[model samples]
Target: MDASSGNSAFNNSVAPLEGFDKDMLSSTLSQTQALLEHFNISDIEKILNMSSRTVSVMTQCYCSGTLREILLSYKSVHGYFSLVVCVFGTLANVLNVAVLTRKEMASAPINRLLTALAIADMLVMLEYVPYACYAYLVLPGEINMPYNWAVFVLFHCHFTQVLHTISIGLTLVLAVWRYIAIRFPQRSHILCSDRRCNVAIGIGYILPLIVCIPSYFTFKIQATVVFENDEMIVLHHVGLSRMAKEDDELLYYVNFWIYGIIIKLLPCVVLTVISCWLIKALYKANRRKQALKGYTNCNSASLLPSEKRAVSKSDRRTDRTTKMLVAVLLLFLITEFPQGILSLLSVILGRCFFRTCYYLFGEIMDILALLNGAINFILYCSMSRQFRTTFALLFKPRMLAKWSTPASQTDVQTTYV
Candidate 1:
């Protein structure tokens, strides 16, 4: 029976197995043991302190619960929601790429990084659209996918991950660069130069893929035959590799350490720390600006008008850029930090948590990431005046021309970040 149909069976058969009735529990345990043996499910003894037999029974009962049914029910809903979000986000990121890469905007090193980020985010959304359509929109029983399509599915899995990881890396670098620009403006020209930013962006793309290479071996395409509508059909899907199936410890460590710590947890922690530093630096800079303003007012006759205006303009631009980046970093924390924590918890809590909690909520996490990827355009539009002006100039040049004055044109020419 399909998962939805089995909800009733789950309700009736699994609820009683949770109680302390010895006879019923014993019968359920016996059946679970037989099922495990039939399926050749290994590593039960390593998961918990309980006997392998009891663990097997408990795992079976745990999976066959209300939570599973609820997750199953939401599957189609998430699929439809993700599809819409991906479509919108893809277009948004495309716009972001076009706008950020324009000559006026691209002069800023940060904008170049933003351009790379937009490309990565755009690819992520574009790649997910097809997968979402197939996996969620299409009915499983009706799916007659070719074995070769599994290659795309596999590529989709790895590619999205590599891209997302690159996004995370780029974000971290962005934060650090912004911090250096703000905290050490004197050295920023040397430290945050175009060459350095270009190298950083290249590393951001390449390093993540290198780190994710081992993960490519964790799953393989497995083909199976099924009888459908009185006809035999072959279907292919992703399954655990021989190494993954045989070496549970290796899989656990790879997931727990490599994915959980290095990819998710480490980046989240570093970003959080760097974000805090950025905020602190902004505060100090604000105080300095206030002090300088007071001094300028008192010494109005002594200071050159042009020099005073220059200082004020530079300060204002720095403040705006820092504030916008802080918002971006905050959004990243909101979306990514929880996933990192969940990854760690799933590893510690064993397969049940991994399947029930982590795997069940996978789509929700994906949608969150996609939103983060797509929402950058909105953030840039709202927070960065230069971005907005440039966007208008690019797409609505005639409209901009009508409003353009020499002063406003000069303001546009002066880089924002």
Candidate 2:
């Protein structure tokens, strides 16, 4: 009975009655004929044409077979995949927050930004669950709840845009922080303090909220016509307000500049420039270090043990952390750029412009963004030795307890003897 095409009784129950409209139209026409002379001929013609067009559109099915297949496939496969990503991504980000918040790592400027990034990613992932349900479960025609869908789209769209913007902004800040730290080491402490970084992160979240405030008022639910099994069905769809729809051109341009430029393009441009400079600075520093190899080796014995170890460990960790962050920045750019481009096109060219390909591509870009958030922890794990060690320690406390047991201690004593 739940099947789209296999239920005969359900289809019959929804089918139109034969001669029903004809009988009603006969009575209405008979009554209208009595007042035909009172009405203008042109007005009558307009009314009939409007009715015909409305009927034609209502009886026409939207979305093609291939599009339905794609939707179904995405719902069955990607929906669950996205669910997994959100769940695991949330856990990973929680662990990232836990590990980075420890006393050992908490005070550093980069760690502060990284912690903020984890929180932002976690919020985005949490928001993804409803969005995935909207796109995959509800959109595939399994459920019909237009009002709920409209309300959720309003909140989900705004919250997601804000959270995603914050994540990107924090990343941009991180890149700039690293650039200053490496290229201008003396001023790094002054320019990139924890207070300043926190302020920047705050601005990152707040600016997006201010920018996306208009969305809350612009969207509304509209009744849309569709045909299934030759039966006309009216469904609710989310659309812009009457005012915005009337002045759609202006709205498109405004959104293109506001959402496209400020939210997406600007951060991308900043990150790219900063990333390039960071790379160049890193390369130059490596060459300089290589040139100082023999001099450093000769002077090594002249320094205290702690000082030598600190310098070596600090330099290596700084380079690794910077490189890891740069990788995250690059991956974010790759995953998110498409959605920004799509937003501009969707607004300017109209949502119906791409048809099936539009939905397919939009869904793919969304998944990519989700993937970007989901993999940040992996980047940290792979790139930072300290992160890996800390993560292991946090997750494997029982093993450490076993290593400190009396029998293991006695074994160590026997080996020393």
Candidate 3:
């Protein structure tokens, strides 16, 4: 090649790269490394080291890799398996939402409150839970695309927290509504209505959203807090990345206590106390009413035995609704009450004391919360015969059984909550 042509070609095409001799390339690489050193992620190295400790832990969990750690990281098989299992939860919650909202509940305040809860739970399951299952369990370690990260963070901070809090508050609302129904049935219509119940449900969501806004600032990727003694705290907490100071950790935990007390404990305690009172009142009223009924029956015993059976049937029908509400309250206590008591226990005893038994205990309790969403449908179905008739009407009007079944008056199941 001519010297002039070679010179022109070198300068024109490779001018920017002409300086990258071995020495220059080495210098450039060193400079780039210096910049990366400032903000490089140590997440993968730390995670790999932590996985061995999972053997000592009770709630063992591990990711396949930090996008590169696990060999089978991107397999569709794992995704398929996760989808199959988590889909069950999604299906169950959807059924609950559909049943509660679709059924035409009788015009009662309790029904109104329960209807709101059903809708909220439905929104929760549909919107947040499925994504959570995959993000936390199914995905390759530390899935960090900007878009998915944004979606995951929003679900964790806003949708999941808001829905769970609202569901609990709505449960309390249902309990209080029942208390009013039982303790002041005479004034119940005046004090509680579908419209008023609607307002309360709306407020329940608004209050939780106000609290969870802080969560948006705090909530981050799920993490573990292992103490010096090796007790692992495996749940979601505020992101440490956002916290500027080391001392702020104390404030983070304190914030949890505040949220727990107000959102979980206070409401449960209040509802439990009120529920006891309502149950007592219901029992007493039933006793007195039964005694009077017996007295009337004795006086007319000689005159009309058939009429006595008729009265008994009517009384039974009316009490049916009460029986159904009792069942619902019992279910709530079974699922939710344990969770509150366990929270208090964990705080007092500390999570490590009992050999990490608290983690399992909490998991069991979480199932109850899950079931809270699950059983609303069942409660509605078993209680209001009118709801049954109406649901049947909506789904299959042509198959309608003419005339509702004779609901024993004592068996008059109406949603009090």
Candidate 4:
């Protein structure tokens, strides 16, 4: 071969390698820039370690190679799951409202409050489906969804926020009512009347509306421009994120106390404390009843059988309802505490503290909170024999008719307690 031909071949090979190196370097710089823009970090090594661990788990469980893909998959699955909960929750709560408002049940104050709660739960479930769809299906795509739909979904936040407040307030009222009944039984007759329950329900709706005025302003939809596919697109998002980004210290502090403490933490603590007391009262009452029955052998003349039976049955019924409600309270706290903690931390430390992980965790926490409403009817049915019978009769009349003789009417008493 000629020297000239050999030299040309070497130059061609070296030229291609130089182009490849430039391409690689450019890609690396762009990726680094994007990472820095998204994450504020003093320690790149710590972020890298956290990313490595998160990526490994994401890859192993979801078979996704990128965090974007992992998040999309996560949102998609949970979004559809949330829709299912919305449908089922709506149906269950509708049934709850129907059964609890019936003449047989509506005479009692507790049933009236539960009926209101069912209405609140139903509204909450209905509101969530659109929000989840917007976040997962619309936000990720960024261009496919119509602008009108995006605006409507974003605006739905206000209504959902009101329902959220009402739901929490109603649960708190239930805990307080049960506490009053167990702690001060004599006052319950006057304090827990239908008039008082109606007043409380009115307060539950109005008070939440009043307290959430600031939240209505804080959580409004925001419009901003973004470059996608080298074209500018306008996007709408919840104002909370923008507020967090702007580092509005006063708003963050307000959110930390209002959303974190009033809406979440206070209710959780109240529920826990009241539930403990109710359980203790039940145990003591049971012990006293047992003692009475045992001592009746020595003082059978002093204690009337009718009085003994009435007191024992009344105590048992109260205990059963209290136990069921305690279960509801515990479930609410369990599902919601993560979100509460995240809200507080996000406010105290700023959104950059946990980066993407915080947002992802927040999404999961939202689904869990929705699940609390979805499963409440199941808890009621499982705990209350009257509720189960009413539910069976309402939904499965022919099935219930096969076994539910006229004699069963005597057995299935009302769920007044």
Candidate number with greatest TM-score: 1
RMSD of each: 8.4, 12.1, 15.7, 13.7
Quick one: RMSD of model 1? Answer: 8.4
Instruction: Go through the candidates in order and give each one's C-alpha lDDT.
Output: 0.68, 0.60, 0.48, 0.60
Q: Which of the numbered candidates is closest to the native, going by highest lDDT?
A: 1
- What would the per-residue lDDT of candidate 3 be over residues 1-417, giving only the tens digit for each residue? 000010000000000111113333333432433422221112222222233264245222322225223312322233344344335545655554454554344355566566667667666555545553554344333323243543454444456567777877777777777677666868988788768877897898788777655434443443432222243322232233344123654444444454456656787678678767767766886888878976775687475776777766555544555556666666766665555554455455543321233322322333445566666566756765655554555556554545445542222343222
Clashes of each: 0, 0, 18, 0
For residues 1-417, could you state the per-residue lDDT of candidate 4 as single tens digits?
Answer: 000010000000000011123333333433534443332221121233234565355334322347645553554476578788889989989988887876666777888888888898898777667665665444443333245653554445456656777888888899998888877888898878878899999999998777755554443444444343455545333334345335554553574467666777777788878878877887887788787876866776776897866656676678778888888888887875665665566566653433334444434565676778888889888887667766666677575477777644543563344
Q: Residue-wise lDDT of candidate 2 within 1-417, one digit each (tens)?
A: 000000000110111111124333333443434323332111122223234455344223334467646653553566678788889999999999998886666767788788998999898888778766655544543324355664565456556767777787777788787888877878989998878988987887787677765544554556544344455545444445555445644553465456656666677888888888777777887898999989999999899997987677667766786788779889978876666665556455653333223333444555677788889898988887667666655677685765544643332222110
Once fitted onto the true fold, the runs of candidate 2 whose alpha carbons sit more than 4 angstroms away are 1-76, 138-143, 225-234, 345-357, 398-417
Give the C-alpha miss distance for residue 68 in model 4, angstroms: 12
Q: Global lDDT for candidate 3?
A: 0.48
Model 4 clashing residue pairs (backbone): none
TM-scores, one per candidate: 0.81, 0.74, 0.63, 0.75
The digit string of per-residue lDDT tens for model 1 on 1-417 reads 001000000010000011133343333433543433222111211122244566556556344578756665665476689888889988998899888888888899999999999898888888878876765555232435466566666666677777888898999999999988877889999999989999999999899878876667766676645443456655455545677556654753574557667877798899899899989988898788777877778888887889878877887888899999999999988888777776777667766665434555565577788888888889999988888877777788575587765675576788585
Clashing pairs in 1: none
Predictions ranked by TM-score, top down? 1, 4, 2, 3
TM value for model 4: 0.75
